[model samples]
Target chain A: MATRVSPAAEDREQEGDIVERCRGFMCPPVTDINVLQGSKEEMRTRMEMLIMETQAEFCRALQEVDGGTFKVDRWDRKEGGGGISCVMQDGKVFEKAGVNVSVVFGHLTEEAAKQMRSRGKVLKGKDGKLPFCAMGVSSVIHPKNPHIPTVHFNYRYFEIEEEDGAKQWWFGGGTDLTPVYVNKEDAFQFHNTLKEACDKHHSQYYPDFKKWCDRYFYIRHRGETRGIGGIFFDDLDSPSQEEAFSFVKSCAGTVVPCYLPIVYKHLNDSFTDEEKDWQQVRRGRYVEFNLVYDRGVKFGLATPGSRIESILMSLPLTARWEYMHEPAKGSLEAEMLEVLRNPKEWV
Target chain B: MATRVSPAAEDREQEGDIVERCRGFMCPPVTDINVLQGSKEEMRTRMEMLIMETQAEFCRALQEVDGGTFKVDRWDRKEGGGGISCVMQDGKVFEKAGVNVSVVFGHLTEEAAKQMRSRGKVLKGKDGKLPFCAMGVSSVIHPKNPHIPTVHFNYRYFEIEEEDGAKQWWFGGGTDLTPVYVNKEDAFQFHNTLKEACDKHHSQYYPDFKKWCDRYFYIRHRGETRGIGGIFFDDLDSPSQEEAFSFVKSCAGTVVPCYLPIVYKHLNDSFTDEEKDWQQVRRGRYVEFNLVYDRGVKFGLATPGSRIESILMSLPLTARWEYMHEPAKGSLEAEMLEVLRNPKEWV
Candidate 1:
């Protein structure tokens, strides 16, 4: 009798080859190697691969500037799927930096469904629960130099399957900058780089997403934006899935280019103790925005088996809260505060 | 020519005398001195007076131990009320201490009314708006010594008038402790003091309120209580209005006594830098509890024209966040974590 091989076995063998070829990712992909390899043409596989690549690239770029290596943690959720978290703390130039990628699979609870409905998503599930797959790469980098602004970005792809087998998918992400001291040239360069990325995709992407960023990152109680605006857009199920993916990829690629120039310029800049204190005060506001109002953080906290370390890695290593702390009039700190209170067009 | 004084004029004259008699408060009460003195027999006036007195006493007691005087700010809210905020930052013994009292009058927004309804309050109003008066004294003291522990307490009374002229009144407040290290003796003394206060009014009060405190101060995402429990109660309108007032007074009175002994014992204790770092880490959780889950903080941030400084005064002067920070097994930090993970019956 001739030796025979089942198609599933053949797929697994081929997957093993692919997995070997794809070594040096932050870790093994959260999705099964076989599934990832067999579904080479699927959007889920493509997104997963993209985030892994983006996370590694970003971490390496940051490492090059900071002269520090990231400590990586690969974690699994008992419910389903898992994530990879990389953090660099107390580095030479960076105070704390975290880059994370998670591939999660779960059923949306009724409460989560309700929140989605409020956000204008329509669902056709009898029990208000739907199976979903979500993958994302998120990061926040807090540098030691006060002159170098803290930068944050996250890009995610999500798919939900209703009871009737109807499927819906969307992509979301943004990049934002928060500087301790206003540097007009750096702001111009940052926004111009992002604008160039957006213009390549769509003429309206920069303006629309920049406005969305201002709105979304608002610290309402303080009547100020979290930082100078960048670009923020969500629920983008646009012209086509391929086009949406292209746009997200463009945004994700711009993070290092947009931020590293400022970092390099300020990495060696001398700062006063007063300036450092002011930076800590601003970090306090950053903490308030994340803990009080960040949607991703709220969702992560609510989700069972969520990796909290990854979720809260965005916070600075140290922060301060001085009651009624206010910058004196006509000072550099006040100028920055003014910009935060009234967001400016950078490009 | 005997002055034919109108009754209103006579009341004003008498009120001025009463106001002068109440001169030693932290500052003039948030309520108008005339209204506060003239309405002395009303629950509104009584509650305001009690809070004003409580704030002054607490501030004085803390100042005595810390050897630092509070910087007082009497702020007016444009919409309808004002507050007196007393804060001492970077004191010798205390890192940050704030005691605040506010008397507010406003129409409850639909969102606030809905929150109350969800909490099992029977709110009746037209268009979900009800006129209300609220007064409270709140304090959070963070000591410099890691061994001393941090203490937070609040006492408030509220009254609402429905469109149909129905009135509803209630009292709410609690006291809790957060320690960097577990000291069983301190825990016992703290709980015993609270138990004595609760027992004076009702035998079941200690058990019921202690459980409520544990539940209320929970940091759910961390799967731990904020600290060792004390006493917490809300919507206490039963037995009789007078009786409820008496109970609130008793609880408020115990704060100084319950906390000071611990402070005195640890005031001059030597601690290593490592211990201080751990304390900062614990303060980060305190920040999480207040900013993320504290109901009063949520309400304060939501209210328009609310004084942000007063609301955020509960935060510590400094705090720290470390990625996936865990204590060594069998360490004092681990022992404290065990108590937080599983709250104990101290009294």
Candidate 2:
């Protein structure tokens, strides 16, 4: 059972915790754990650690709230490959959910490898297929509370063998929030935290790329924005290894501090049963958009080594179907429509 | 009340009719309705005559098919502008049907005019918003026969005010087919007819743009082609009015010959009641794809100048939903799935 607290109370506690954590944590901390800089084994080991830490932190945060505690149901390790499937069900915060985190290292098929090469990149393998390895940490958090956003984050590193057998690695990751309700302040705080982290890298990075994220998540058919917005960056690689390393580290470190407070504040708020029902209805659209239109979902589903449960983790606990129901005039639902019609810069 | 004939019987009669029609029509005729394009008043009068002819032809086709004539529900003129909305419903070949063909010429909103201006080439619109005009024939034919494909065809001429106060005119249209069943031979016949028409214009045209039509009609989420495919081209405007006029005329003229044979062939075939039911279920996916992802549907729904029935006319008569039911192994459904999984050139 979760200890109940008001939204304001949660906010105060979260703010203090975030501020304290920010002060104590310095960038580029020393790590004694060996992560091989040049080998696929090193990448795989590092990815495994990353997955454990990310999932543990997610569970710890969820347990603090009134929603259910999710236990990892299964973890299947791949033999000829590498992927871990973790599923959870009937939890206070989640219902029938799976959080899959996997790191795979393998060669692409001939056709697939050719397409990659045409994109001005080469892979390692005979028959023109490159020997490439990837470490991806991905999660779908479908919280029990409709007010609590169903969030998604994916961070991955890719490396390929060169002609001389040298490995070249690149980093990419982004965290995005998908909320049922529109709390402008929560959205602001979410983007603000991300912007601050991004500023440490480059000033132009936050605003330019944040707008890109907004455009990216938009469901053009529904004419609505997906969740408010957050930080998203991809292909963060450079000739300089140090620069790429710093970028990935900064993004990964910002995830917990940036999102947890917003989730914490919203989870405890007083919401009517009616609002919860509306939330579920809205979630149905999210599912349709993701399953039907999302490029990431399509790509992952089409991929050979895809873990289906983890890929579909962002689906809601419940959804609805009406003959056709446009939101009532001047309601919160209508307000959401107005916001959607005109894109806003929350940060 | 509808006429029924064997395929072999019709094939012989159809050939005879074609021979008689082509005997004297083979002599190339040169003519121009150029005077009709002199002014808006002249164009309007010419369009009215064309509309009357089009309506008469449609009425004749229906009367001959059913022996009992289908009644036109009514034709409504625009309250604030000049346009006709011809509608009909609950006919022998159609249920909940609407055939709306309109020719309206008027001014556009400043925003709408501005968007047009961004296309780089200025039309005959004023520097700001000027008197904009359009004349077009658009129709959606939804046959009650699940065996017969639901078809859509549109031929439009758009004129906009240029920055210099001249009129910029262009023509655009094409016909497409959506079939419930996978009949490769029928699909081939349909495309072959259209390709022959297009080939008469430019040798390179059919192959290059036929692929475009196939790619455009795809519902990416379902990974299914909209129907067996047909021809589609938009904005066939060029600098020289003479060249543009000839191309546009060719595009619009191809509709009849390309479609008539395919329609006769499909409609004459008998279908079982169960097949009809299955058609409806497939239509459900069509509805989901359109309402959920189609841009044209979204734009029509959002725009003030939209007609609901016309926009939704692309929907099939029936649809089905089951909780995650994959088709039986080695069935026709699986055959369709095979095609959907990997598209190929049928022609």
Candidate 3:
């Protein structure tokens, strides 16, 4: 019933390839494990730097593609941190897009620390201050083309101060694709790119985290995954701090390669009105998952000085929810739901 | 920006009023307190009859007004209950609307009983099966005309068995109005109609439950009430069951008088594309409150064998979310938000 489209329409596929914005800045070569040696604070600082660079580069590249203007809002948190949110709306290629980078440093309140312990993290400073710093790059893109899947990427580094001056640190995040229609080659490309990034860090990266993503993004009520599974790792303090930081660096660095190709693939493809309506419906599911079930979003909403706009910028510009809607049994839409109900091993 | 709308739309103002569907049934007159006598099962059966009648009459009248055919789906729950769902979509006046009646009776597990106790219910069954039965009629109307406010009504009866085989009985429900564009005449009519119903039962009914509705429907994160509240009461097992049942019946019976005149006033009123867009945006807030904050929605989702479609029929067919969306200064949209942030005393 809400199958209404507005005028002022533009398609990314109708547009040509984006002009590269990276003129002279060379890529930071992967730091060797020995060279990456650092204390928790040092690692946090490095992660913060990398995340900011990623946000700038990604937004610039996106701005080139959609020819959309990005509004950059930088604000400080009273609780000892700040963030920069770059958002684009009504772009030629993208409908709504956000790339946010935040680095927060603060001690957890007693109740919060206790909740964290209940969630299974061993805190070294039980009575003392549970000093923590979290840094991350998070992005969500809702493309103009329903055929072009909505994609999300987040990679973060976390440090918890321990008793006796020791510290606990780890990295977490993943990238997932939510398509209005399941395009096989696009899905494969998405997973393969992320798989390559993961394999560069560890052999177990793709398989373990891929399964974790399947579990992590599951929409229990709907009995389906949010999208095709991607790598998701949390509390990943392994081999050494250097190795972990390097791995997160690799994951963070590979975001564009992992997502852009698929964007290009469907950029110009024409879609029927039905497909667009279906896309809106799928987006309704996305909103449901983020608001009702996503822990990261829950934490953000609960955290003091939380930026509501950046937190909810993940929602699509428009969505629909029909009562008890179901696609005809053998339709392409039905096929898409089938795949989502049971995610595929794309790589 | 989602501030866009399509051209192919009609308004309800152009249509004539619905032929009254109350012709076939006679209202049950209130019983005097001294003469009232009924067992728990007898009272529950009477409530069920009244709710079922309400659902049928409401849907029949709506069908005449909207010129939209209703699809009736009746199904039974695995948990010793069943429901009837009447849905109309893409109507002449309503984009989507639903009227549903459910009668459910089942035994609560120990954990569920504990949760009830935590909510301030003094359940007698500490280690035994808690017997419970609930009957209710709930309806949500999402009109096509942006000027026509969305309305929701619910009245329910609950009966719980104590360890000593004694029954605890009560009635709870209210009707609320959510307008995309606030109209003073409409707000006055809505409150006055509901006030008349409340005053028939008790002098204090309007004030106490109006404040409660204001508190209950608040969207905390957005700092706004969900709508201009009507009335809401729970666990009202006092002043005799006869008075309570008669009060809820009076409330339910007055739904048409409360909403029909407003719908008629705005039905054919022309609106700009911007107004329709704002309506969609406000509906997004409605969706947020129901999904994130409504305890009834949470209960519906958590309860075993809950009819998902009926539970979610309250959602609008379409919604839009724009990042950091603020209405233009001194605009009608802005004024609506101002009132929502500080709910008014409308009479």
The DockQ leader among the candidates is: 1
lDDT of each residue in A137-197, candidate 3, tens digit only = 8999999889888889898988888877788888899888888887889888888988877
* Candidate 3 chain A: 10-residue stretch with minimal lDDT: A10-19
lDDT of 1 by residue, A82-182 (tens): 99999999999999999999999888878888998898999887576789999999999999989999999999999999878978999999999999999
Report the Cα lDDT for residue B252, model 2: 51
Pairwise DockQ winner, candidates 1 and 3: 1
In order of DockQ, best first, we have 1, 3, 2
For candidate 2, give the lDDT: 0.57
State residue B197's C-alpha deviation in candidate 1, in Å.
1.3
Q: List ranges where model 1 is wrong by over 4 Å.
A: A1-21, A126-129, A163-166, B1-17, B126-129, B163-166
Poorly placed runs, candidate 3 (over 4 Å): A1-41, A124-128, B1-41
lDDT of 2 at A292: 57
Given candidate 3, what's the lDDT at residue B161? 91
| Model 2 TM-score (2 dp) | 0.50
lDDT of 2 by residue, A1-347 (tens): 12212222222111232223323321111121333223323544444444545555655565565355454433333423445444455565565444455556567556656755676665666556567776666666666676777777777777777767887667766777777766788778778877776666667667766877778778654567776667666666653555455555566666677768876776566778877766665665666567556666766666765655456555544454322336799888777667766767887
